[model samples]
Target: MVTRDDFTEERIKKLEKNLLKVRKENRVKEIANKMHEVLSGKIISVDMNPCYLNDLSYMIKKNLELVREALKKNVSDEGSTSNVP
Candidate 1:
């Protein structure tokens, strides 16, 4: 014994699920684009002084890791907010 309301509710839920999937994909795409830009625009020189090169290389790696983590946290936060009661 199903009513029109039941069908509508199911459809809404399915659409919401699909929307969330799309949002997550878009976020990943945006992060990848930003990462590509950062790598392309900020080139490191191989002939740089050894002392400075090592330190700078470590810093750049750390910064990129931080950026990736921040982006992940942002996506998680957005998803959580959407589920608020």
Candidate 2:
């Protein structure tokens, strides 16, 4: 019983959903890349001593955790706002 208009509408909705998914993926990648750049710079500046290397390792791990949490919060916030009627 579906008409051409109905099919077109469904197609458009699917495309919109895909677009949103792709945009979110791109956003996550951008955040990760920025984080990588910052971490690389920090790593390069650190001294080669064992103590400094250990500290840098810890900092990298902590920063990665923070980035994950931030990205999760961001994605959740975006989902909540984007789905508004």
lDDT of 1 by residue, 1-85 (tens): 7799999999999999999999978865654554455578966456757765554456568778998999999999898886658
RMSD, every candidate, angstroms: 17.7, 16.9
How good is model 1 by TM-score?
A: 0.48
lDDT of 2 by residue, 1-85 (tens): 9999999999999999999999978865655564476666733444456754565466568778998999999999898886658
What are the lDDT figures for the candidates, one per model? Answer: 0.73, 0.73
Those runs of model 2 whose alpha carbons end farther than 4 Å from true positions after fitting are 42-63, 66-85
TM-score each candidate: 0.48, 0.50
- Report lDDT (Cα) of residue 60, candidate 1: 61
Candidate 1 whole-model C-alpha lDDT, 0 to 1: 0.73
For model 1, give the 10-residue run with minimal summed lDDT: 29-38
